[model samples]
Target: MLEYLPILYSIFLVISLCSSIILLIPKVSLNYVRIHIGVLTLPPLVALLALIFHVDNIIWGPLHFNTLTWLMAVFVLTVGLIVQRFSVHFLVGDRSYRQYFSLLTLTTAAGSLAWLSDDLRLLLICWGTTLLGLTLTIRLKKEWQVAKKAASTMGRYFTISWFVLLAAILWLTQTTGYWQLSQVMTQDSLALLETWEKTCINLLLVISVLIPAGQWPFQRWILDSAVAPTPISAVMHAGIVNAGGILLTLFAPLFNGSIAQIPLLILASVSVLIGTGIMFVQVDYKRQLVGSTIAQMGFMLIQCALGAYIAAIIHAVLHGLFKSTLFLQAGSALHHDQPLKKSKKPASFIGKFSGIMFGILAAIGFWAASPEDAYQLISAIILGFSVSFAWMQLIVFGHGRIGRISGLILFIAGALVYGLVHTGFHHLLHETIGTGAQPSIPAFLCLMFILFIGSAIGLWLSRNRTSRGFTILYLWLVQLGEPNQAAVESHPKYLTQYMSQGGKKDEFSINIK
Candidate 1:
C-alpha cells in the first residue's frame, strides 16, 4: 500500500493536466469549470491521505514523497482550487478563459512535480516547466502592454536564476557524486571539500533562490508585474514565488554551518528593511502588497538562514494564505470610500516604549523555545518583528482595552505556536526528511543584534515623525522603486490601447482609487 503512493500521486497529476487540456476544446461549455475543479482536487486529497498515513520517503522513479513534499502539495492544491473558483466568476466572458485554466493546472502540476522529485536533474526540469507555465499565465492579458512588459521582465530575471540553478545542480552532482536529492546530504567530508567549491555552490544556490523570492535588488520585477490579472497575481504571490524559500529549505543540509549562509543572511536582512520601508510609501495598492510580500519573503529567508526550517515553512504557508486573500479582495477596497485626509500626531514616547517592550518579550519567548543547539538569533528577531506588528495593530489602529487584550492573546498564541512547531516539526522533519542545521551561536547573535537595532531605529523614526534626515532617507528609498516617467510614456495607453485594438472592456478590470 505504501509503495503505491508515488504512482497514485503521478496519476492524479496526469489527470489534472489532461482535464485542463480538455477544457481547451473549442467552445467548451463553461460548465466544464466545475469538472476541472474536481480534477484539481484529487492530488491534494491524495497528498492529505499520504500525510495521514504517515507516508514518507517514498521514491519511485524520479518522484519522491516526504513530509515536506506532501505538505507543500496540499498547499499548492488548496490555492489552485481558490484560483480556479475565483476565475470562474472573474473571467466569465473572456475568450481565453479555457487557456487560462489549462495553463493554471499545468503550472500546478509542474510545481508538484518539482516538490516531489528526488533526482536533482528532474527537479531542475520541473523548475523550468513551472517558470514557463507562469510566464504564459502572466501574459494572459495579451493586449495589455504592461502585462507584456511584466512577463518580459520576469522572464529576464528568471532566466538568470534558472542558469544559476542549473549550474549549481551540475556542480553539486559532480562534487558530491550524487544526482539524487537524498544522496547529496551523505557527503560528510565538508572539511575536505575545497573552500572555493563550497562557496561557489552555496552562493549559486542562494542567488538562485533570492531572485525569485523578490529579495531587494530583484523585487522591482515582481512589483512591476502588478500589470497581470488579479488571478495571476494571486498565484504568483501565493504559490510560484515560494519556490525560493522552498529551494532554500530543500537544500538545508548544504547551508548548515557554512559561510554561504552569511551572505544570504545579509542580503535577506537588507531586503526586509528596504521592502518594508518602500511598502510604507507606496501610493498604489497592488504595489504596496507586492512590497509587503518582498519583506515577508525576506523574513522567511532569515529563518532559513538561522536554521529554523520549520518556522520558515510556517511563515511561508501563513503568508501565502493571507497574501492571496488580500490580493483577491484588493479590488473591493477601491470600491469603498476613502478615509478623509487628516493630520495625525506621532505616537507618544510611552506608547513607543511599551511596543518595544512587547516586541522584546516576544523575542525572548521565541529564543527560549528554540532548539538548544539551533540558531536562535534570527528566530528571536523575527518573533520580535511579528510582535511589534501586532502592537502596531492594537495601539495604532485598534480602539481600547478589547483591542489590547486581543493583541496580547494573539502574541501569546503566536509564541506558543512557534514553540510547538519548532520542536515538533524539527523532530518530524529530521526523522522523515533528514534536513537540520545548527549554526554558530556567536555569529547568530551578531545577526540578531543588528536586526534588533534596526527595528529599534525604525520604531523611533515612526514615533518621532519629525526627523528630517530619516524622512529624506525614506523618500529616497521610495523613489528607487518609483516608475520612471519616460518609461510610462514609452508604452501605449494602458487599457485604452486594448480597446483601440478591437478588444472589449473587461468587467472585472480593477479600478484604482
Candidate 2:
C-alpha cells in the first residue's frame, strides 16, 4: 500500500471520478466543472514537489520515482491549468463543462499513471484509458463536425493500438509465465524468450510499439485528431503521445541484441522521414503541429533504438513542453483573430542568424571531440535539418507572411547546421571505423562545408522570396470551405440537407408546410 504512493499521487483519477459523479447529480451546475479542474491541478504539483524533496526514497519496486517523472507531471499539470483557464472563458455556463473537465482530468491521470507505472500492464492500461478519455471529450463537442470526425478516428486508432499491446502482453506472459515487469527484464527471462513462443512475443511487442508511436498507417489518426480543441490537442501531444516512448524506455533492457535494435531503428527512421514530409504539406495550424509531434516522436524513438534511452526521454519531455506551449499560444492567437499572413520580408532574421552560428559551433565541437562516430552524427544532423525544414514550412503555411518567412529562415539555418554536424560526424566514423583512430581533419572539413552550404542557402532564399507552389497547394487543400463558385452552388443543397435533417429554422426559414 505504501509502495503505491506515486501512483496514488495522480490527481486526475480522483477528479475524473468525482466530476463524472457530479455531472450526473440533478442539482450540479457548470460551476462543478471549474471546481473539478481546480481540484485536478493540485495532485500533480504536490507529487512533483514531493518527488523533488524526497528524490531518493520514491522508488517502488521496478518504478523509480525521481525528478524526471516529477518534472513531467509538473509540466502536465501546468498545461492543464492553463488550458482550463482558457477554456473557462469560452465555456462559461456551457452545460458540457463538467464532461470536459472530467475528460481532462482522466487524460492527465492516465499520463501520470503511465509515467509512474512500474509494470507494463499498468502502463498499457493507463495509456489506453487516456486515449479513450480524449476521444470521449472530443465526441462531447458534437456541435463541431470536424471535432466529431476527429474523435471517431482517434477512437478507432486507440482501440487498435491497445489491442496490439494486449496481444503482445499476452504473448509475453505465455512465454515467460509471469506478468511482472521485473521478471521480464531479467537475464533468465530473456534466455527463456529465445524460444519460438518468445520470438512471437518479441514481434508482437514491436507491432505494439509501432501502433502508438504513430509509425506507418497508424499515424493518420494523430493527424485527423488534431482538429480537436486546443487543450485537447496539447494534452494528446504532450501527455498521450509520450506514453509509447516511455513504455519502450522502461523495457529497454529487454530489447538487447540485433533482433530488437535493427528493426526498431528502421521503423524509427521511416516514421521520421514520412512524418516530416507529410508535415511539410499541412496548412492547418493544429494539423501541422500534430505532424511535427509525430516526426519528433519518431526521432525520439530512433534515439531509443540506438540505445540512447536518456536522450530519448529528455527529448520527449522537452518536445512536449515546448510543443504544448506553442499550441496554447497558437490558440490564443486564433482566438484574438490575429492575421496569419506571409510577410514578403522575413521576420526573425537575427534569430535565424544566431541559430546558424550556434549550429556551426556545435558541429565544430563534435568534430574536435569525437572523430570516429562522425558519420552517424552527421547523418543525424542532416535528418534533423530536414525535419526542422518541414516544421518551418508547416508554420509558414498555417500562420502566413511573417510566420512563413521567419519559420523558413530558422528552418533553413537549422537544417544547414544539422547537415554540417552530420558531415563532420560521418567523416569521423569512417576514419575510426575499424581502427581506434581519434579525431580527424576530414570530419571538420565536412562540418565546414555543411555550414557554408546552409548559410549560403539561407541568404539566397531570404533574398529570392518567391512564393512556392507547395504553399498554394497546401492552402487549397486545407481551406475550410469551397471557393465562391462552390459556396454558391452548395448553399441551396446545404440548406436543403440541414432542413431535411430537422435543423431548427431561423429568420431566413422558408416554410415548406
Candidate 3:
C-alpha cells in the first residue's frame, strides 16, 4: 500500500501532460484545462495528508516520499493550480496560452520529481528540467526585450547553478559510492574527505542553492524578470525560486555542525542586510517585492545555517503562499496597502524596558515550542530580537494603547505559530530525514551577538534617519537600489501600448516600467 503512493503523483503528471497536449487543439478550449489543473492538485494534497497521518518514510525503488518531499509536492501543486487558474482569466487573449500552460505543468512536474527523488543524480536532472522550464516561461513573451534580457541573464545563472549542483552530486557519488540520498546523508562523508575537498563541495552546493534563490549578485536576474507575465511571476516566486531553501533543508546533513556552516551563515547574513536595505529604498512595488523576497530567502538560509532546517522549510512554504497571492493580486493594490505613516523618535527608557519584557516572553515561547534537543542559540536570539523589535516599534511607533496591545497580541500569536509549526516540521523531519546536530555553543553565541548588534544598529538608524550622518548612508542605499531611470524612460512604445490595453504585463506603473 505504501509503495503505491509513490507512483500516484507520477500517474497524475502523465494525465496532466496528456491533457495539456490535448488542450493545445484549437477546439479543446480552456475550461477543460482549468478543471484538469484543479484535479492535478488533489494528489499532492492527499499525499501530504497521508504523510501527516502516517509518520514513516515511503521508499519504493528510487522514489522517496517523506514529510519534506510530500510538503514540497503540495506546494508545487498548489502553485500550479493557482497559476493555471489565474491564467484562465489573465491570458484570455494571449497568443501563446497553450505553450504557457504546457510549460507550467511541466515545471510543476519537474519540481515534484526533484523533491520526490531519492537518487541524487535524478534530483539533479529534475532540478535542471525545472530550470529549463523557468527559462522558457521567463521568455514567454518573445517580443519583450526586457523579458529576453531577464531570461538570458537567468539562463546563464541557471546554467552555472546546474553545473555546480552536478559537480556536487558527482563528487558525492564518487566519494561515497552512494547514489541514493537517504544512504548518502546517513554516512559522514565529510569526515572522510580532506578539508579542501569538503570546503569546495559545500561552497558549490551553497552557491547552487543561493544563486537560484535570487540572493545578492544574482538578485538582479529575478528583479529584471518582472517583465515576465504575472502568472509566471506567481509561479516563479511561489514555487520555483523557493527551491533553494528546500534544497538546503533536504541536504541538512551536509552542513550541520560542519566547518562549511560558518561561510554559508556569513553569506546569508550579508544577503539579508543588503537585500533588506534595498527594499527600504525601492519606490516601485514590484522591485520592493523582489527585494523583500531576497531578504526572505536570506533569512531562510540563515535558519538552515543555524541548524534550524525545520524553520527554514516552514518559512519557505509560508513565504510562497503569501508571495503567490500578492502576485496574483498585484493589479488590485488599492485594496491591500495601508497608508504610510511618518517616522518618529525612539521609545523612552520605560518603554524600552517594557520591550525587554516582551523579548523575554518571546524567548520563552520559542524555547517552549522547540524540541528539547534542538539548538538553543537560534531560538534565544530570534526570540530576543523579535521581542526587542516589537517592543520598540509598538512603544515608539505605535499610535496608542490599542495599537500597542494589538502589536503585542500579534507578536505573541506569531511566536506561537512559529513554535508550533517549527516543532511539527522538526518532528516530522526527524522521523523521516534525520537532521544534523546543533553547532557548537560558542559559534551559536557568536551568531546571536552578531544578529542582536544588527538589530541594534537598525534601531538606531530608524530612530535617527533625519541625522546627516545616517541620512547620507540611507541615500546611498537608495541610489544603489533604485531601478535605472534611463531604462524606465526607454520603455518600448509598443509594449506601453499593449500594457495600456491591459495585456499580460501587469506591472504598469510609470516609475517601474
Candidate 2 whole-model C-alpha lDDT, 0 to 1: 0.61
lDDT of 2 at 153: 71
Q: Least lDDT summed over 10 consecutive residues: which range in candidate 3?
A: 504-513
Q: Give stretches of model 3 more than 4 Å off.
A: 1-3, 188-192, 335-352, 364-375, 391-415, 440-453, 466-472, 483-490, 496-513
lDDT of 1 by residue, 275-314 (tens): 8887888888888888888888988887787776776787
Candidate 3 lDDT score at position 83: 84
* lDDT (Cα) of model 3: 0.76
- The residue ranges of model 2 lying beyond 4 angstroms of the native Cα positions read 1-16, 23-26, 57-72, 93-95, 142-146, 195-200, 332-360, 367-513
Q: Which of the two, 1 or 3, has more TM-score?
A: 1
The clash number for model 2 is: 16
> Which residue pairs show collisions in model 1?
none
Ranking of candidates on TM-score, top first:
1, 3, 2
Worst 10-residue lDDT window, candidate 2: 430-439
- Per-candidate clash tally: 0, 16, 0
* lDDT agreement of model 1 with the native: 0.78
lDDT (tens digit, per residue) of candidate 2 on 210-281: 766677656766766665667777777876776666666666656533355455555666566556555666
Which portions of model 1 miss their true places by more than 4 Å?
Answer: 188-192, 338-361, 370-374, 388-392, 395-430, 433-435, 463-467, 484-513
Cα displacement (angstroms), candidate 1, residue 503, comes to: 8.2
Better of 1 and 3 by lDDT: 1
